[model samples]
Target: MASNRPAPESPYTTAVFSEDGAERSVGEWNPTAETVRPVRGRHRHRVMKQRGGFARSSTVLGVGVIAAVGAGGIATAQNKPAIAISLPDVDSLPGVGAFMSEDAADGAEADRERTAEYETMGLAAQEAQPTAAEALRSRILEQAEDQQAGAAEAARAAAERDAAEKAAAAAEKAEKEAEAKAEAEREAERKAKEKAKAEAKERAEQKAKEKAAAEAEAKRAAQLAGSYALPTSSYTITATYGQSGSMWSSGQHTGLDFAAPAGTPVKAVGGGTVKSAGWSGSYGYRIVLQLSDGTEVSYAHLSSMTVGAGQQVSTGETIGRVGSTGNSSGDHLHLEVMTPGGSAMDPMAWLRSKNLNP
Candidate 1:
């Protein structure tokens, strides 16, 4: 009987025996018509189909790897975040589903899901990048602030300069005013001094004129005193010429009468030569004098005569003494004046004309 158990497995050998008893290593084995097997049936067909599907799945995976690498390079060149591309599940590829086992299909589907999650993460990173417009706005704000500060500084400088100029102008004006005031004061002082000098000079000239006039008057008085003298001292005129009186021999008095004490001295009336000195019938001792102008003066009724006829006598010389020696009632002297024509004139008037008021 044949054992019901399964046959033992053949061991692996590298040798084969030939029918003529010749041995040969498997490495030198060659297929002949009798040894070559022909495969057939549905099992063979299934194996061929599996090989084709595997080749198609491998090609699809290579295409997906190339696409992912190209996208990563582009993202790097643009300075953007890395991006992930989700590959399609290998079991879903054409002809690949037939070759893959149930477990392989499930793993490929999980890898696809993971790739999509990474792609979402890359999109979020790209959204966070700063834009060109935001950077430009920040730079514009900084420039505006700088310009505002510069404008403020310029305004402050301008104000200070204006203030300094105004101050200088004011100072100059004040200086000019002070100079004008000083000049005016000096002019006033000069004018006042000039006026005072003029006044002083006028006063001095007036005083000189008055002094000259006084000196001239004094000289005139001296000349008149020298040329004439009073006839007698201490005498009073008792009668005048052309008067009516009982003591006069003529109807009207022809001479002036000077009444005095008995011994009063008589003087020459003016400077002249003595014409006559003697006693007459009606006239007591008397003297007659002849002046330079041919006029004659007579002193009568004297007690005694000191000058005689033809004797030269000067003014103010004692000629006689008073007495009642002529037709007189008392001790007196008669004074007579006779012009060059022998006409009798009033002696008192004649004496006054000679600047001698007696």
Candidate 2:
């Protein structure tokens, strides 16, 4: 195509648009057809490798889009909004773009196509690594779940075992307590039995002692019966011992009197030796008999004495004759039993001890 611009001038100038949206000339020069051409894929262009002095360069910029009007120029002033501009593509430069032949352009386009394919392959490799990481994380989560389940089961088993051991210990303690209680009861029963047996034996021994004492008393009574006898028969008792009356000298009678005829025979009461046959002051005629057991019987108011002094006489032998003698109110035998110490006894109680009821 032929150029519309006329010619070049000495001082170079360019055209620009103003703030009022008008076009005007700022400088004058025509870039001939050799120096300019249509833009070829301007946004996608890259810088080529340097050859000779002709180096072509391109760059990507993140700026606002330049909107255009009728003329293709940019302009701005201070404090004014910036206007748009459009660039004209050139085919040749004095030292650049001249070495870029059609063959080299084709080769550059092939290299760009191969580089895009290689970037796509690298993207696939990066995506595969994250997928494997996610799978490994899943495997770790599954193992953690299994371990938790196992731990829960083990804890439950241990709890059951501990409870069982505690139950067994409690049972053993209870068993021992029961046995101890039973043993204590048995011991109490044994002591009670022993105490009862001892009490029974004591009662038996007491009864035996009582029986022996009774038997000994009976034997003594039998011996007294065999050894002693009553003095006289066919006589009336008068003037008993401890009788009070002024019959003669002593106010109280000291002997038992057997009333009989004046010549009645007085017999010896028991086996005895004659202690005396004499005439006493109050008794008149008297005889004192001494028994083998040291007891003395005196017969007073005897009319006559048949057994002399120191005569050994048997039971019922004639010892004297009854008579009304000195201090006697009548013919009666006055008999007295005396202890060896000369203390007078109740002759009635004394005869009973000898098994003589009278």
Task: Please give the CA lDDT of all the candidate structures.
Answer: 0.72, 0.67
- Give the per-residue lDDT of model 2 (tens digit) for 1-358: 5554444344756664454547765766444334333223321132223321122222111011221211122122222343433333333433334435564456445544544454445445434545655676688888998898899889889999999999999999999999999999999999999999998889888888888888886565444423666666667888788999978457888888888878888887777689999999889899998887888988998898888898887766788788989888898888888998889987776777876765
Clash count, predicted structure 2: 3
TM-score, each model? Answer: 0.37, 0.36
Residue 259 shift from truth in candidate 1, angstroms: 0.7
| CA deviation > 4 Å runs, candidate 1 | 1-226
What TM-score does model 2 achieve against the real structure?
0.36
The numbered model that scores best in lDDT is 1
> What tens digits encode model 1's per-residue C-alpha lDDT throughout 97-214?
4434443445445544655554455444344333433455578887888888888888889889988988999999999999999999999989989988888888888888888888
